[model samples]
Target: ADAQITSAKIISLDAGKITTGSLDAARISAGSLTADKLAANTITADSGVIADAAITSAKIASLDASKITAGILDAARIDVGSITVDKLHALAKNLVNNYSRTSDLTGWTATDGSIVTDATLSAPVHRVTTTTNRQILSDYFEVDPSKTYKVTLSIKCDSADGTRYFGLHAIDKDGTSISVIPFTVSSRTFGGASSNFYFWSKGGATGGWLNLEAYILGRYIDNQSDVPEGKVVTSHCRMPANCHRIRLRYLNYGTAGTARTSDHFSPTVTAVDSGAIRAENVIAGLLQSVTGNSWISLDNGQFSFGNGALAWNGSSLSAQGTFEAVSGTYLAKLDAGAVKLSNSGVELGYFSIQTAGPTGPWITAAAGASKINLAKLVGTGLYTAYQIDWGTTGGTSATHRFWGTVTLNENALYSGAIDCGAIAADGVVSCWRVEPHLDNNDRCGTTTKRWQAVHALEGYFNKLTIGSNTCWAAGSMSLTTASWASVSFGKTFPSAPRVFGQYTHDFTGDIGMLKIRNITTTGFQATIGGSGFSGIAANWFAILV
Candidate 1:
């Protein structure tokens, strides 16, 4: 019994430490053992025990076909470089058919020209055998009129000495060329120097067909002014390049045209280099507008306005005004004439016609051919100043009266005749009076007064030595002098003169006192007594009152 007990104990101990070969499927109890009882990474697909709830994600080393389920992966889960170009091309749409011309010009039509496939060129070439314009047009392509596109092409000369004119034309649904932009290429070598030309096109067709045309013609003469009407030419002296690799790219579109509503035009060409010809057209339009009433300033020296109306050339400024029928009153006007104010000195800022006083009302020119009387008054107003008035009353009229005060500074000079009243007024109404004020020695600050009724007088004193208070006259008389041998005074005095007379050669026998009776303001008359006197001489002095 002891031997049996010991053996059973050893057997039970060995059973608890059983090796992998000691355990069999039958030894394991179903639903009794779990994955928690095994070490980490001990259960895997190779272990049949993992048939249900097979290894959790944490136990896997990496993912593979056996680890992942079918149709469970998506683009987001797929790694990069897994997709091919063939796959992408199958999903996208190509707007430009036959973009590379893999097949010979299958999607293009040539008018008056033929497509020439050249080994040297990357794409098919357009060959023109005539001087007339030729075109290679693409099939009508559907496009959104509200979008803009960039059209590009590479151009070079195909034949040496064979210059060509090349341009891009946009045709609308109505078959009318709406926009045309062209350039020239001038090169003598095959595959000569070429330029990449780019242009913008705002889609024009509205629910209609739109197409692009490439035009090729003989090289345009440089600076040629006699281009045929309705014909396209290049302002530059370059031959067109062998154009190929034409492409259209999506750009900002949807811009409207300047023409009719619902009518769209191609996008405005904005390339500064290619659009120079268009600039000439724009300048021409501006010049036309200048012919009307528009004013254009060019630089600082040149300016123009209206149609031959006003212009300032490099030298002078010119202007013209039209003469229209006069209907109402005008203060001042220039009719069919021009008033130029060009001065190198101090200029008048403005002129005013006002009343005599500084605070007086404004004065307007008379209506029609009416005249306003003018008068000059000196030292008349409160300020005792000189004034020029429009009316006879010196700016005192109830209507149409104006005056301006004249303040003469020191050393001021006026050299002109003052037409007082008509000739009937004796041409002398007042004389300018300059008086120094006793208050100050300054002549400019002195009070000035004009003396009225002052007349001018002139005379000659002949051989007379008169005193300071008297004027003397003397002359000779012949022996056969008449009864009235007059002694003449050359000029007049302001008032009548008091005459004192004596004869140097007096008559002795029939002596007579020298009578000086007819005394006038100008001169007094003197006579000798006898007519038989010869070689007689007389002298007299006349004192003027």
Candidate 2:
């Protein structure tokens, strides 16, 4: 009906209800409808009143998200699983690479029997199934120092003991642990039936170990903590300060009693959580501890390792504690002024410098600071068989001074008169230096033995050659008549020997004389001085000056 009539005025409207298109949308004001104009609960939603696909996205421009003010949209109105990840715009993303089981986990480094295994775990996991201490360290990731970050690790351990756990640490550019950085355990959810929410943290002495330890505590059993097998633990950490980089450590330590397996799953490290990172291991703690004047300092502007134990710093370097090499087998310990070296915890020997001697410097070594039975050899005989025979007289065996008959090859100095048993000679007997001061006055030996040694006939009766001549020699030879006679000697000298001989006959008044003329190394020549004499003998002698 295009027109309606009012009963009172007989107009063209009957309360505007009988008219079609009487109140057009273009002519109607927005929000002009009043509930009083209609009966309460009059209009109902049905196929007759509303058509299908009537309420489209374009039609909902009146009730869009911009129009959602002063109240929250009921989540119940949205179907389950209708809101997807793509629907949420600019959500905080995980900073960790391969957080899901999307890759082989190349972002982690395995240490000590840790590996990437795809076994019974639902996804390929970073795992360790060793009897030794096993760990896997994640690769260093860049982080923001301003915004707070949260790291989540999904780990499964065969041991519920707290010893098997994971840790979070911040490192520098050189991969060294940074001190004075603090973090918090934001949240954690345990999976196993026997999982405990308790954790333990140890502020290490050097600020390098056990910074933040999130572990799986065992269920109580008889006042002792017992482990549950195949437990899964999830930990979320929020760090306040990360100057350079961050790494995660998942470890299985002290699992000796039983074999243990640890598995890691989908993890995340996002900067969604907000908080201020506080200080923990500050350098002031370390600087305050560097007390006393005996600090580690540079000496002589140079540093060098002296021997295998001590390090030379200018003049000296005193080591405070035991210094172990890269391999634990080699160790150097300092006790007093000596440095003891060892291999595999066995004290081998030590090197010490004798500082109290009159000499300048000496390197002294001792054997384990104890008297141990050891073997030594002298020549072809052992030291035991070559014991010195101390020839004692006034004292007992223990108190006797060494006057033994033993022969030693060492340089010795004696302070008493020597009573020789025998001075055996197997080679040439030659005397070099002989200083005879027999008298109380240190002048010389008495004239008797002094002259006797110089002109001894029987003691030293050998030919002495002085450059080109011999000392002295004498003998008797026979000479006859007017013939030239030769004086024969027992042996020849190294040089031409001097000969002086006078012929003396046994016959009375035999006037023949022998005169020596030429001398040679072999022999000497002599001729008769008297004429025509026979049957006579002469005595001859030879000497060299």
> Which candidate has the top score in TM-score?
2
lDDT of each candidate versus the true structure = 0.38, 0.46
Worst-scoring 10-residue span by lDDT in model 1: 263-272
* Model 2 misplaced regions, further than 4 Å: 1-93, 110-121, 160-162, 173-175, 180-242, 275-545
- lDDT for model 2, please: 0.46
Q: RMSD, each candidate, Å?
A: 22.9, 23.0
Model 1 lDDT per residue over 339-368, tens place? 211123212111234423775444333322
Model 1 misplaced regions, further than 4 Å: 1-107, 110-125, 130-135, 148-431, 435-545
* Native-to-model Cα distance after best TM-score fit, residue 279 in candidate 2, in Å: 26
